[model samples]
Target: MAQTPLPDHPMRYALANELHARPFPVLKAPCRAMYLAIKKVENAAERDRSEDLAHLEALLDRYGASRPAPNADQYSGKLGRGFLKWEMHTEFVTYTLFATEPHSEPFSPDLFNLFPRDWLADAPGRIVTSCVVNVETVEPEDREDYMNRNFPGWFVPESLTASAVTEDTAVVVGDFQIDEHGHMRFAVLAHPDITDSRLGRIVQRVLEVETYKSMAMLTLPTARKVSGTVAHLDRELAENAAGMARESNEAAEVLRRLLTMTAEIEALSSATAFRFGAFEAYEAIVMHRISALRERRIGDHQLLSEFMMRRFDPAMRTCRSSKGRLAELSGRAERAANLLRTRVDVANQEQNVEILKAMDRRAALQLRLQETVEGLSVVAISYYAVNLAAGLLAPIGYKLGLDKTHVVALLTVPVVIAVWLGVRRLKHTLTDGEDGHG
Candidate 1:
């Protein structure tokens, strides 16, 4: 008999397997890495996906490497002298290449020669950032001499931050400067005892720290651009809000202005929303990576953590402050709009009250006119009824030897009283039924 299992959800396997995706590279000491992040002028999410795929395919074909499956967001494969890992992100695509061979010179341009010049030139998007990372294995005793010799050549000693990380198994150093090739430089000195996996994690963290830090700073310019627009909106909102107190007629105009401001703020918010969120997220990632370094100071020299905090913390703070300001301004604008709307509503209510008062006056006039018409109707009906009675009673009066005028005089009061009572009773009956239904 065949075994039957319970039905599985469509995404069960994929969701469960996601944790293993993008495993860290196993990098031994004495390895070299060239990391490149590419981004289009428009966001990667908005750019044509086919274009990115085609670019990757072209690059892989040149290296005799198989292309990624369709719609795959990332791929890792061997190239000429190194293996390349490509990942497509929301706003950019990153290519990380690693080679086991170390360059003799610390900041050699020959390291970038692994990439074909023509292929790099034809890349789909501009390079947002690129870095050359060299990991060297050092004996624990020779570490100080290694830094003293290399620090002056590659980094500014005055501003150098070198520290032991991963329980002093490795020491990483960088001055965070762009070199002549327009590439940032990072180097890792690991002990021979460190495992390849731990070294890989350290290398990955360093690269990520640099990448996210660069990505996070891109938002500062956008923040500055919107700051002026927000200030102008704030002043306009304040003026419009103040106008609401002056006159009821101005309420409509104030409401219109408030709506315009709301639209403007919303538009700005929509435009910058993604950037703000990305910056915050990337900033957090940078912090996390720095923390993962577990850096300890080397001989009074600042560590990477301290250097990052001193330089990057201020920019991050500015971004945070700008975001908060935008939110506050938006909230203030919304409240002003609500206030203006309430004022307009109150004005409308007051106008309606005046209209009701006019209607009441008209209703009172109509009631008085109706009463006058009723009185005239009673007179007319009485006159006609008395005439008819006079005609009928004339014969009887002649028989009884009484006058025609006296019969009419006697019947006039009763007829008038009867018609008035009948009209009043009819009106009362209608009103009573209406009241009962209500």
Candidate 2:
């Protein structure tokens, strides 16, 4: 028997891996709490399965009619993201219930009968049967109790930590290291379950988790391009006070209109160059910032302030060679745009030449059509003249004891051959320019 390949738990993404550094998984709800197994999007069969989502109303109608024994009343969820997207703002009612007994037997945990552990035992997973929700959620006053419990992954028995406490919420953050054979796995846990309301705590926790994951997925290349453009603009203003970028804001109300006008290049004929140049500028900014940050020449909070200052400043604080290079580049860009236009015009002229040749061919054909028409007319006229002469001669033939029909036919043959040869001679003389008139 052939062996099956093992599945990768955390899936890899192609675009993210190339552009960013890692795969991005949405950590918000309905994406967060899913009933089905999370599979790689590249898998065709799994994608098809997600597409087959049933409406909740239809499922509710099928109890004795459409739904089976459990019915809509028994289930605690609405229709959600299957293999595809769940309609946004819609949610399935899902929770963990604590029960004294196991939920393996026929039971209703919703009736306040089962324990939280029972719900955990019945947790839904793709392949794993007992996949449980990470119950890191807790309340402010009860934070101490949760801390002591020392949950499996997020919290540990203790190292040095700083905690913020409030009447509504408490954020207890700490570092933990777990033994994985000889290697130790590290995790940063922020136990933010403490809140006046359990639901409020849950919302905050989920949102925080989502925000963290999103920030991690953000592509550095994209950020760099954005930063570089701002830096380049700032550098330009520094070089010349009268430059477009350095123009002082005397007309506050008309600033937006001016910006629109700036972008209005009667033609962005080479849009690719413009876009790529802008992106490259942003990339340069990112790199410059990274270098500054690394050297400790700038503070963490100073980046935004500096960027904004550069944007608002009428004149730059320092002038550099980059400004001169940018001026030269702008001139070069205009030249490139003009060259592209010229190339297009040259191509159009070449196309026009081809069209002229085609028209000349069409004119030759029309002239040939006229010649053909004249030849047919001559042949018809000559044939009738011959026949008339033959008919007049046939009377004599009949008188001489010869067939009149045979005499006329034989006379017509010579006339047709002579007409054909004469027409060919005429065509040659005219076309080859051998006529006396030519």
Candidate 3:
């Protein structure tokens, strides 16, 4: 009998498979590489992903290469003498092309011919970054001559940073400068005996360092733009907050302006939140990649990590400063708003108190007026009642042998007292009933 099998979760297989989705490319030394990153001008993450896939398929079709699966964000295919790798990220897509054969000259424009001219022009998004990376196998003895001749013409010596990385397994050099074609360049010289896979890993890390560094710097302009706006908002908030101390200040108007400022600040934060986060993450990746290099000094020149610290550190600090300022301003505005609301509430309460006092005075006047009216009503009713009694008793008095005027005179005092007592008793009864209900 077969053994009983255990059940698996619905997402178990997919989650496990996702871990191995993107693997490092296999590469050999003596190669030429081109890398391109594309991102839309607006809302790159929300752009039509289908367009990216179509662009890749079109390029693949040109070389009779295999197409990627449906909704695939990554693809690797063999070209004539080169291979192409495509990977999609949240805000951008990257294309890396590699060839085993080396280009004789350094930083040649012809190396990019691997990509179809028409296809590159018709790419779905604009090229956010692209670079020419050349990998060569240079022996330990010839390293000096290699740098002296080609390095000087292409890269500035003052700015060039070179290092021996991977436990001295390879030496990499890049000036981080844009060339005439508007593309950065990197050159790596691995030991001839190094394994192809190891070299591939090294090359990948170098490219990632460059790419992430560029991506991280994109936030600098945004930070600058936000800085100016934040400053203006800060000044306005300060003025309004100061106004709160004045007795004559318009509390409600100040609160309204604070609310409007709060809205603007919140909107700005929301709009730039993603960009700030992406910048930070990319900066971390760049630093991580540099550390992974495990670089040692090849000469007196600065290493990649040092160069980045010297140049990229300031831009990162600027971003951090702007982010911190925004936070502080938001907190200040919130406190000011709460204070203004409290003031408005207190003023309203005072006004309500005055209104209640006025109402009480009016109620006292109404009660006094009602008492005077009740007194008049009793006298008027007594007069009419006495006259009516006189008319009715006049005949009776004549029969009893008494005078009609005398009969009314005796009843007048009794009738008035009785009417006053009856009205008082009725008022008491109605007031007692209302009190019970209440």
Candidate 4:
């Protein structure tokens, strides 16, 4: 669509810019969805609002056709196309995310920074989208019928009664009845600020209201997959418990087989390669999918919180219910992801411990061998020193004493014994130090 300039009015700009916001809330890609709240109709083609009053009255049918139409100022047709027509109204809070639509890159939020918050949103990505509007020419009395017709068998967020939540009820007759414009309006009037996502919520609220006519289908394949994984894990836990409880001999055999299989699974999945393989990868995929789904709902909730004002409506209850459900689902997803993450951490730690133990054992063996070699070297040194001493004494003989041969032989024997003992002590000391250090 070609860009068109709006009137030079702050309110108009606010409505237009907010509705056409870019980079959507969740998807980083061009927006794939959007919502719009119809404000007042300005002017119809080729006629001033006043000049078109006759036709407008006929079209709106606010008062009976047999009845007289009210003054132009009192109604849209009587007043013209510029009537202040609105299903939702805002007094204090302004509209945000009034509409969303996908656009080309050159014009997409990805390319243009549309909001002040985009400074943060741009760092990541966003998804923006739009709906295909089905314009129909229908009678004015067909508003409610049209809603039920278009959205058949659909949940109406607006229809979420107080009794559904707290059994509360109030009977407030509508005083602001339709004038002579012959036009129809919504009975479920929600103040714009009252809604969580004033603009977007209106779209969804309308979706619910018109579900019988225009049902919006949602795709949750990823959500389903994660849910399936959770269920599967639940089953596995039950099976493990049942296997542990079995007492029959055959059951005992089965338990043994189960234990062996579990060990094999651990072995096969224990490798770094396997951790990076399909099983771990899919687990990660499921975690990511769950996170994304939760995030989308969270974004919706946040949008609602910001957009919703002081007005309390039935839609608010429905929105709260939806948000609560989303929170619960998110908690479940987080728990599952955390379980997998913890398992991964434990597996990695165990691998490291095993490696350290292996290194310890190998180092001990190496040190023992080294000590044996060093001990042998010390003994050889001591033996050689003893022989040298004996040789020196042999020349001197026993002249200094009584019997020279006996002195040389006995002296050598005592010297050899002392040296051998000293050498053994030195080897023992060396081995002790090595063992201590190792």
lDDT rank order: 3, 1, 2, 4
- Candidates 2 and 4 compared by lDDT, better number: 2
**For candidate 3, lDDT tens digit of each residue in 292-372?**
989999768899999999999899999988888888888889999998999999999999999999999999999999999
lDDT per residue, candidate 2, 42-141, as tens digits? Answer: 2222243222232323433432233322222122322221111111111111221122222331222122222133333332222111112122334446
Taking all chains together, each candidate's TM-score versus the true structure is 0.88, 0.25, 0.93, 0.30
Q: lDDT tens digits, residues 196-240, model 4?
A: 333233223322232211111111222333345445544554564
Candidate 1 structure, TM-score to reference: 0.88
| Candidate 2 local lDDT, residue 398 | 88
For model 4, give the RMSD to the true fold: 20.2
The Cα RMSD in angstroms, rounded to one decimal, for candidate 2 relative to the true structure is 21.8
- Minimal lDDT window, size 10, model 1: 1-10
Residue 93 in model 2: shift from native, Å? 12
Q: Which regions of candidate 2 deviate over 4 angstroms? A: 1-168, 174-196, 199-348, 354-438
User: Ten-residue segment with the worst summed lDDT in candidate 2?
Assistant: 82-91
Compared with the true structure, model 3 gives a TM-score of 0.93
Give the number of the best model, judged by TM-score: 3
Q: All models: lDDT? A: 0.85, 0.36, 0.88, 0.34
RMSD of each: 3.2, 21.8, 2.4, 20.2
